[model samples]
Target: MHRSTRDIRLAEALVETADTLVDGFEAVHYLPRVADHCVRLLAARAAGFMLIDEDGTVSLTASGTHREVALDLLRAQRGGGPCLDSYSSGRPVPPVSIGAARAAARWPEFTERALAHDIAGTFAVPLRRHERLLGALNVFVATLPPETASPDDAASDDGTELRLAQLIADCAALGLQNHTAYVQCRTLAGQLQQALSSRVRIEQAKGMLAERWNTPADHAFVALRQYARRHQLPLDRVAQAVIDRVADDAELRRGARGGDDGGRA
Candidate 1:
């Protein structure tokens, strides 16, 4: 029921990093932070991330390929590795060697290719939302020399590393979620900006329509709304209709020219 001091320190560090991410840490530099944490704390030889696209496909997005560049894109079309599996399962997947996960069988080609690079083990941690799947954080370990233990009992020594890997995975998921939220906020802000710009443009064109048709501003607005409803177009598009050189449907254009006071004044 007691936690170790080392775990407490690790947890505190993760909390600090996650807090930084929540506070606008979506810069290009953050990927290296993730990589450093994995490499320094979790015995990971390599670190990578997969971003989940809107179409539900996961693509490799970042990697620590060298000591300087810090991020690289894989030169292959392959995904659905341990990272994808972890995202789908919403849990940690640690293949401490190809054998523990039989990754060579489950993901034959990727396993073979990754092993050729001395990456013989992998762990995938899911980046999840409350109810949505976001992405994955992946860690790979280089194969130890055969002379270390003949590669037969290597797993026995890997147990502690595996546990630490999972813990690191949890921290990475929290960090990733914060970054993802910041990304979504940026996307929503862009959409809102476009909408507001369109509205103002439409307002300007509506004013033009009222002047040309000699109609009151209110009447001009009515005509625009009616046209939009009749044609099943958005209001901004209708305003554009009156401005663009596209169409000049007489009745609608005339409505923009002037207003009848309707006698109730």
Candidate 2:
């Protein structure tokens, strides 16, 4: 890709990441788009994203293609690949020659699997926000000559590609954090709305019971609460029942009489 064209695509990818912060953002869809952008912008054969769970298990979240997905799955299962290393260290893992004897020594199973898939080299950058590590992005190189397959290979020796990859990862991490906060805020707002609605229903029920029993609203509320406790039902449910005229009138009146006596005492 030309330098100018690649720059335009990079800007577009960053914008896409930011766009996901809005409502209705789906991680399942967004992650694959990010992985595809990585592969294209970095001129890599394949790319994938892996996320670490709260329980410390790393899993493949998305990939540029089915082949990359399989490789990512193998690496995650083996738990000793570049992506895992980057996530664990909270730093980028430089390009590693997958077929190297040293790589075999370091990550025997993963290296063997990657070589079998015709992957010559692998690079990884952590998806992190400062001290908080979320996951890692893996880049696969399919064809690197033996002479240039070292970690200091010309492909990324200048560090331009690595820096670009890290910038993309950082944008993704920030977008994910924003999405999580937006979801939490929406959930909290829903809970507050429900609570307010429930309070309104309860007040309406109290007024109805007070008029029916010819008693004060406070006494009627005591009766309603006692009925709910006796029936082992939620206060909200009982309130709704009173509003719907499904509550037992006789039982409520009995509770009202008891409340009256208590008030007198």
Candidate 3:
């Protein structure tokens, strides 16, 4: 591909990746798309990514193709490879020409699987923020270009490939961060809404008791609490029952008296 064309495509890919940082981002849907772009635009044969959850287990997040999906799972199952190395160390793993016997020897099981699957090269970059690592992005190349045919041969374009991988990984990291924050915010909002709803029900029930018996609102609240405690029901559920008239005024009066054998007046 012409240098100008490659540059334009690369810029476009970065823009597309960055656009996923919306309020309700879905990582499962976006990561694979990014992997596909890497294969198509970065001359990679395939691409896959792994995410390390809070529990420290590796999850195969996305793959550019079906073969890559299986291969990524194998790497995770084996527990050793460029992906883990990059994620654990927060560094980039240089492209390995898997076609070469020596290159394949570094990750023996991974190489065997790669050979079986017709994948001839692999590269990885970490998804990290400062010292915190989230996961790794991996790319599989069928064969290195002529000048860098040998794994030991350092090609000028290798740096470019590494940068592109890093760019994509950074985008994935940002999207994940945004998604996490969005979920937490939603959880908090839901909790607040539930609390407010419960409070409203309790207050409404108290008002009903106060008007029916000409008692103070404070005394009515005590009656609600005593009933909830004596019946072993949640305070909110009992309040709801009172509001719905499921609990009669006589029952509420008994509850107001504390449900004791020697009840309060």
Query: Which candidate number maximizes TM-score?
Result: 2
> What tens-digit string does per-residue lDDT give for candidate 2 at 1-265?
4456666888899999877657778887788889888877776677888888778875675554655544554464354778778988999988877767344487877776676777777788999977899999888767756674444333445288889889999999998988998899999999999999888888899899999888988888888778887989887788899999998899877677553444310
**With candidate 1 superimposed using the best TM-score fit, by how many Å does residue 225's alpha carbon deviate from the native?**
16
- Model 2 off-target regions past 4 Å? 1-3, 22-26, 66-79, 99-104, 144-158, 259-265
Residue 203, candidate 2: C-alpha displacement in angstroms: 1.1
lDDT string, candidate 1, 114-168, tens digits:
6566566777766655556667677777765667543222444455656665565
Model 1 / residue 95 / CA error / Å: 2.8
Number of colliding residue pairs in model 3:
0
TM-score of 3: 0.80
Clashes of each: 8, 0, 0
TM-score, candidate number 2: 0.82
- What is candidate 3's lDDT per residue for 1-265, written digit by digit as tens? 5455556766777777777546657777788888877776667667888888879886675554664444553464364788888987889998877766435467777777777777777789998766678989888777656774443222338888888789888877876776677788888999999999999999898888989888877778878877787788888898899888998667668655443443222
TM match of model 1 to true structure: 0.52
Model 2, position 80: C-alpha lDDT score: 79
Error of 3 at 114 (Å): 2.5
TM-score pick, better of 1 and 2: 2
